[model samples]
Target chain A: MMGLLETAKISLRSLWANKMRSGLAILGVIIGVGAVIAMIAVGRGASLQIESHISSMGSNILIIVPGTTTSGGVRMGAGTQQSLSLDDAIAIEEECSAVSHVSPELSGVAQVVYGNRNWSTGVIGTTEGMMDVHNWSVSSGRFLTDQDVRSSTKVAVIGETVAYELFGSANPVGEIIRIKKVPFQVVGVLAPKGQSAFGSDQDDVIFVPVTTAQKRLFGTPFPRMVRRISVKARDAESIYLAQEQITALLRQRHRIGPNQDDDFTVRNLTQAMEAAQQSTQAMTLLLGAIASVSLLVGGIGIMNIMLVSVTERTREIGIRMAVGARPRDIRLQFLIEAFLLSVIGGIAGIALGALLSQTLVLLFDWSTSISPSSILLAFGFSGFVGVFFGFYPAYKASLMDPIEALRYE
Target chain B: MALIEAEGVRKVYRMDGVTVEALKGVTFSINEGEFVAIMGPSGSGKSTLMHILGCLDVPTSGRYLLGGVDVGSLSRDGLAGIRNSKIGFVFQGFNLLQRMSALENVELPMLYGGVPSRERAEKALAALKTVGLEERKGHRPNQLSGGQQQRVAIARALVNDPPLILADEPTGNLDTKTSVEVMELLVSLNEEHGKTIVLVTHEPDIASFSKRIIRVLDGSISSDEVVIKHDGIA
Candidate 1:
């Protein structure tokens, strides 16, 4: 058998001699690997964006919604019973060791009118601590103060989308907007936070003092009742403990018996975020699988071209045989040719795929991230494709009868 | 023992349930450093006999010994080793790899023989010089004339310095003038290098360049005789 380097040298010479044919043969592999890498990159980027958005929504958050209630034998869904109160949020903040901060929330949908523009958006009423609990910050004016809630001031903070819709590009601070025919002064405009993983417009809500909402806008008979309570844990590791402590406290405060279910439920945002993360990971793998089909097609293309190459070089094989090359030597030469084609094609594909990913980021403003492991896997697969696909053709070349191959025109 | 000894050598081809006998009980021997030519018309089984002698194909039934080793007993790889180290082959078409330069073509047999690159290069250059085409070593087959291509093929065959050189119509593709030149090169290699050569051709003038002629007709040898030589043996 010839030395591996010698065989490789011969193979490279032949491939260089027929540059056009070699390029055509490798093109399929290039496109196939390029598409696979790009698709994986985009999918990974999207998933990472989702995870970051979920965490940015608020770290270690637990939402407490009122449980179902029965009135006259008809059951009402969660958040309909009005079983939570401001005192419950205060007690949880002070009594639960795992709990760091708490805010009782009262929310409703209202149409706000400023001059001629009218836009429908969510209206949330909460205390001064709601901003810190939700990790929100005001861009222009100050957030609602403790004095504002104590005095029942009719001042509100607007989100970026609401500010844009009502005031265009003009600043909305100190402007008066009527919510449900009740005039209120805008105290601040929240900065843009983009979209949530659940496809909700996050920057389209308005914030007001909890006291002002109950007295001026809602005028509800239940004075201390609120929609839900939002709580924050000291850190991510304390979220589950915070949920358990709050559940026990609420259950005890509501005076529910051992056999009876509590009137409020605690929901762990971390668990929900983990579920969303799992789904996005599945989606990334699915996209990767779909892209890999093209690589298999590329392998078949290699096999087809190698078979043709072997047949085309039948006379050359005969000459090598006549000059005392063993069967394995002939096979190794062609196999090395195919292997080089794939490996070279793979390298070009990685470059092209990165460029394509950058193009996506530039053209459509979509995030694209190429991981090192993906590149390594794609490169390794290309080499395996070369060997697997090149085998039959090289074997056929080795098996040729020198007598017949020499006579072939 | 002679360099090559064959007794009761026969080859049968099975094609579509029909058997064709190409060589039937042929017996011949040639001493070391002898120049012999096998002459026959087409379909006289001369090529088949050459194939068997070169170890390119195994006979169906035979007792053939090359360099005192039984050719029929060696494995496939062993036969390859023997062919690589003991014999050199030249063909009618001057079967040089067209994509490689003449130097590379000449280096191929040595490459298969596992000769190191430095030695292979030196010996390839020396073989090209022996064939008097060392100046054209960098030219590809298409760039060279038919005669030069044949000379490159001869250099490729001589790079290993094998004891036996097999030439099957070495000048078949050349003109009369080129053919005479190629025949003279073979004669000089045989006389000056003491290399045993087996030439296969139908041309009487080409056969005259060798010391002995073996003529085959109907798959059997009809004549074996030494040519009267003006130029004596080396």
Candidate 2:
């Protein structure tokens, strides 16, 4: 057997002799690898964006809603029964071991009028703890205090979108907005939270104290009671434990027996986020599988061209063998040539793939995160393609009858 | 012992489902330091004999020996080892690898034989100098004339210092004047270095330059003659 260095030298010489053919053959691998990397990158980026949006809803959050016991044996979203109450939120906060904080919220669509301008926006009613639970910060004035909520004050905080629509060039703070013909002072304006992944306008909302909303605005006792309860756990690891504790407590509070469904549903934001993440992982794998087909196509391309090359270089092979090149040496030469082509194409493809992903981020304003492992995977895959595709042609070349090849003309 | 010996050698080839015998019951022997030539018409199978003698092809039936070792039973790798260590080949087409410079081409056999790079370079240069191609050693085959390319090929054949040099119509591609010059160089190598030379040619003039000539007709040697020339040696 010849040394690897010597084999490489001969392989390089052969490639150099047929420079254009070698370049064209490697181009297939380059495009295939590049496309694979770019597709996975885009998929990963979109998935991450979804995950972030889910996370922005707040980690450790357990949204509690009423559940339905269907007579027809079908379970559906939230429940038809009004089993969830503000007292449950207070109880969970004071009783659950894993609970960090809890806030109940009531939301509705309402038309708000500021001076002569009127717009329809989401209006949420909740306790002051909602701000800290949702990570909402006030851009102007102050958030509603516990005193404001307890006194049933007719006060409100407008989101950035509402403020923009009602008082375009002026601050909306200290202005009065009419909700359902009930006047409320806008004590603060929220900072922009941008658009959510679902294209919901996060900034287009108004917040009010639940007591004031139930007593003055809607005028019904516990009117449109808390649709969902938000909860926060101490850390990421405590999320599952917190969910279990909350589930057991709510089940007991509702007198839920074994084998019977609870009257309310408690969901953690982290669970939703994990589900979204798993879905993205599936998408990434699917994209990678699709890209793997291109690699096969690229491998086939290398094999086809290498077969042609072997036929073309028949005389050269004969001459080398006659000059004392062993059969294995000839095989090594062709294999090394094919391998080098793929490795070079792989590197070029990686660079092109990175550039492509970055271009998507820059031009389309998409978020893309390229993992180092992907780069290694792509490169290693291309090298494997080289070896896999190169084998047949090299074997054919080595197996040629030297006398017949010499006489091949 | 003779440097090369062949007894009752035969080679058969199949073409398009028809078997043709290229060599039939051939027998020959050559001592060390002998310069011999084989001459035949196109279909007379001299080239086939040359290929078999050079270990490039295995004979269907033969008792062949090189340097006193039986070669007929040698495996492919054994044959390759013999080719690398004991025999040197030169072809009519001056089959130098076009991408390689003269020195690189000359160094090929030694490289294949596992010689160190520095020694290969040194010996390749010396061989080129012997063939009066040292100055053109850096030129690729395409950059050199037909005669110069053949000289480089000869230099390559000599680089390993093998005991036997086999030239199959080495001057067939050269002009008349260049052919004489190449022939003269071969004669000098035979006389000065005592290298055993076996040349194949169809031209009578080319065969006349050798000290001994064997003529093949109908796949068998018809005549074996020696030629005496005076005042041709310088």
Candidate 3:
């Protein structure tokens, strides 16, 4: 057993002896670890973005809209028929076991006039339950009340974008806004939500009472008809049951047959959102796996160079053995040489990978997050690669008969 | 007391399924501070005998004792320890590590023996000074002449101050001028330093430098005789 400093000195000298060869080997490891880190960062970033997007859309949610209408054999698309209404929304919320909350909505795009500054945005009429259904909150003032909806009060809550547009930086809760020249008092501002998965600005809408939108703002032909209903289930796992319950209850209420076409469609956005999230997670795994292939190639490269170094230094081994070096000493010297290569390469690769991820964020506007665990994993794996590949070469050097090795050219 | 003893030592090699008796039964003993040479033709088993005596190889069926420790009973690592502390070797090729400095080359055995760095360096420099090459301690093997390289090898063999020093044709690659210089150095190491010296060479001029000569033929000693003392160098 050689002293620690002695082994280190020997390994360092050997590595320094052939700078070009050692550099090339270290470069292989650098590229390998770097690819693993950068690829995983990008994938993790995308998945996190999707996660936030899904959360903004709210979870365990179902949106039901009116089915198509056929006029003179000309079929219209979804939401053409005014089949879903305030009554159906109330019945489902009250009757369905899996259903927790519901908000019947009548939405229309209208020009809003506030203090002579005008902006056109979608205005949805709903009750206070809209906040519970969307998991939304008010940043200032208060949301639309049940009293406001029942009395058809012209009170409204604006979103951040609409508030910023009409009121600038000033608070808009105490201001009055007009929709179709019908004045409504601003009651509160919805908290800012950056973007939806559909790439739409979620902070660009307004909410008012359903009765007011049907009666005052955008008048409908039917008395209590609504355009859509957003329903929330008890929890994530009960969404399927909630969707089924909604369909069965609606079909029975609308007097539709089992085999016949229904007047409304119950759509589950949470399932689609979850599927998107799952695919992004898969993409993360896929990126890491692909990058690890390069790492494997790098390990093989290490083994190849080590074998060459052993063959080149056969005479050195013989000389050392002649000077009373044990077989373990010879084996350990070369093993340490390789271990140093990989450990140094691993550190450099981690730095390179982080830099690469930052570069991607800067140039491509891609979101990237470097997890510390990945760094640890990469470092540990690289060290393992070094020792693993170095073993055979070191073993071969140790097993050489000293007399024969001395005689080798 | 005998510092090195061999009794009926033998070595057999099986290469390509052909048995070759590298050494037949041979026996000898050398006391402390004695200088001897084993002289023979090529393939006459002089080198094989040297390897066994140096503990680099074990005898097939005999007893070899270094400092009264039975060599045949030792493990490979035990042999290594004995070689490190009790014996040193010098080869014809001046077997110094090519990339290492002369000082570092000399420090190798102590490095393996786990001697602390500061003391190892001091002892290695002292050994280099003994060979009169302390100033060339930093020079690599390629930077030195053949005689200077052999001196460096001798310094390396002496750094640990082993009781026994073995030279296997130490001057085989040197000129007559360099050969005489090396032989004189070995003579002084035995006379002044009280180191036991065993040399293997084919040239009678080289053999005469030792106090005794053992001649080998066909894997066995043909004759053993004393070398009459004279002006030994050259």
Best by TM-score: 3
The C-alpha lDDT values of all candidates are 0.89, 0.85, 0.91
Q: Write the residue-wise lDDT of candidate 3 on A358-384 in tens digits.
A: 999999999998999989988988899
Instruction: Go through the candidates in order and give the C-alpha RMSD of each one to the true structure.
Output: 5.7, 5.4, 1.9
Per-residue lDDT tens digits of candidate 3, residues B1-234?
Answer: 899899999999999999999899899999999999999999999999999999889999989999999999987778788888888899999988988899999998998888888999999999999999999989999999999999999998998889999999999999999999999999999999999999999999999999999999999999999988877444
- The reply for model 2, stretches above 4 Å from the true place, is A1-3, A59-61, A66-83, A91-102, A106-196, A199-220, A223-225, A231-273, B223-234
Least lDDT summed over 10 consecutive residues: which range in candidate 1 chain B?
B225-234
| Candidate 1 positional error at A258, Å | 11
Give the per-residue lDDT digits (tens) of candidate 1, residues A13-126.
888888998898888889888988998999889878877876567778899999998888999788777788888988998899998888889888999999999999999889
Maximum-DockQ candidate: 3
Model 2 C-alpha lDDT versus the unseen true structure = 0.85
Residue pair clashes in candidate 1: none
Could you tell me the TM-score of candidate 2?
Answer: 0.79
lDDT of 1 by residue, B76-178 (tens): 6777788888999989999998888999999989888989999989999999999999999899999999999998998988889899999999988999889
Alpha carbon deviation, residue A87, candidate 1 (Å): 4.7
Clashing pairs in 2: A66-A79, A67-A79, A67-A263, A68-A79
Q: Summing lDDT over every window of 10 consecutive residues in candidate 1 chain A, give the lowest-scoring window.
A: A50-59
Chain A TM-score, each candidate: 0.77, 0.79, 0.96
- Show model 3 residue runs off by greater than 4 Å: none
